[model samples]
Target: MIVPLRKCLVPEFILGDGATNLANRYIKFFNPKKVLVVTDRGLKKTKLVSNVEKQLKADNISYCIYDNISPNPRDYEVMEGADVYRKEDCNVILAIGGGSPTDAAKGIGIVSTNHHHIKSFEGVDKILAPMPPLVCIPTTAGTSADISQFAIILDTELKTKLAIISKTVVPDTSLIDAETTLTMDKELTAATGIDALVHAIEAYVSTASSVITDMNALEAIKLVKQYLPLTIKSPLNLEYRNKMMLASLLAGIAFSNASLGLVHAMAHALGGLKDAPHGMCNAILLDHVIDFNFESATNKYVDIGNAFGINLDSSNPASSKALLIEALQEFKHICGIQPGLKQIGLKKADFRELAQKAYNDSCIVTNPKDAEIADIEKILEYAW
Candidate 1:
């Protein structure tokens, strides 16, 4: 049997307490002319950004901060950030936040170097030029934008998210500090933790999944199931925080290599359309997508169930599917993520449009089950 070729891509990452402070050390290796510090306004209010700024100042590294980023980063914002990068003569991009700011940084890096509109680079491997050195400090436990080869930017005119999948946009280094996540409120923590779980599950069942990706995905699933709730209950416990961070890293590497599936595809579509929280959107759609894709990846679903500590009866596929879905719903409920699509401002009228957009998303290509627009609409109906 001829094995199909597969590749895994990951950034050089440092993990642990105070890892964010190492950004300046990595930036110095680039010997940047000026660093473009990309982050959201919300992070500016925290000491996290200030601490990094202090490190840059100590190293005498010239830098400019572009904190005008939204939760769902816009194309205009990327263009604007690119302009800032050029105007400041910045050669290195340092992102210090969750997915939003890191994704914006990737967009800025692409636009600054490729000299094209961000929209043109949508889909897979469209990036022609190498982006500037990017060092990411992810404050959130999920999204894993710090280590991902994918960048999602919302197109303001089209009101849809552009999925830019390319190796060129992957960061040079990631500082994955669990301490940074200590400041997240219970809501953010729950949403992002479940987002990591979704990443692992999707990657595990992705049609493109390789042995390497499966190992990472299954371990991530196990860690998330064990640690996510503990972190939520003991919000400030460093041990739980560290474990969740590790889970996020593992899941990020898995999905970055194997790509995701219907849940991410639908979540991206819903997030782009409603400007909703990406993690929350994933949480809402995960179990429904699992139910839809279960038969297509029955063995993989059973593996995931085992990781979740549910002893699914694999001999009985129907019972196994029901058990997995019920367990996932219970997990989400325990994590305080109970809202459905309808509760999050999605209208039944928008289902077709959302499904069409999701079908067109890059992530759908790796889904275990091939999904049509109508199938996605039905999934939306179930989720609603």
Candidate 2:
């Protein structure tokens, strides 16, 4: 008997109270004379960036800032960021924000050193050279690009999303400070939290899943189920925020190893096409995709239902799957996630194109059920 080979990759991450305050230590370890700090314009208004800046300044670390990143980061944005990184002669990259800025930072690292357009690196393991030393501080408890081996970049010309997956693109270090998430609005909190849930669910049910990934995915699901609502209601509750952050980190590790499934594949297309929030797109499509995938991976769905605190009987797989979907709907509603793609401005006319893009996404390859173009189209229509 031959045992299948499985490898896991993860970035060095620090998680706990005041983790962001340790930026100076990590930057010092990089031994770079200058750092390129990549983030969005919106983050500059918050103390999250300033807090890290103050720490960097205290340590006498020189840095350059590129804040032109969009909510749905574009191909051009990555190029522009790379230009700044080169012109500033920055040796290290520091990303401080949600998924967009972190992913853009990864793109910048790829293009600045690889001498290729960011789009060229799209798909799994296309990146040849290792990225510049990167330090990430995530202000949101979702996406988990800081630790994951994936970067999502939008192609404005094609109105689609491209995924760049390479272990080399993973950040050298990441700070998980739950305090940073306190600044997010209720909507952002809900969206990002649900995005973490999607990651765990997709990873758990993915055909690539292993025992190691499954453990992390299940724990992440349980943590999100227990803590997401508490964080949403209180907003400043540090305990809940920390749990959500941990869940996000675990989910990141799970998907980074096991890969994602159809929910991410569909959400990536919808988000790239509309320049929409990726997390919210996942939130809208998660239950629908779960229904589509239930028959193929009923045991995983039952496990998910158990994590959600539902008393799902695995013996009755059909009823268990329904319970799982219903629980997800109720959980999403409680977290204030608006239902349906129509609420996010997706039109029926665009479904066909979105389905084609989703079908082409690499994430779909790992889905437990093989999804065809027509099946993807129906899912999009149903989501709409």
Q: Please write out the lDDT profile of model 1 over residues 207-317, one tens digit for every residue.
A: 999888899999999999999989999999999999999999999999999999999999989998999898999999998898889999999999999989999877899
Give each model a TM-score: 0.98, 0.97
lDDT values for all models: 0.93, 0.91
lDDT of 2 by residue, 269-306 (tens): 99988877888899989988988989899888898899
lDDT of prediction 2: 0.91
Best by TM-score: 1
Worst 10 residues of 1 by lDDT: 1-10
Q: Which ten-residue region of model 2 has the weakest summed lDDT?
A: 1-10
Model 2 C-alpha RMSD vs. true structure (Å) is 1.4
lDDT of 2 at 153: 93
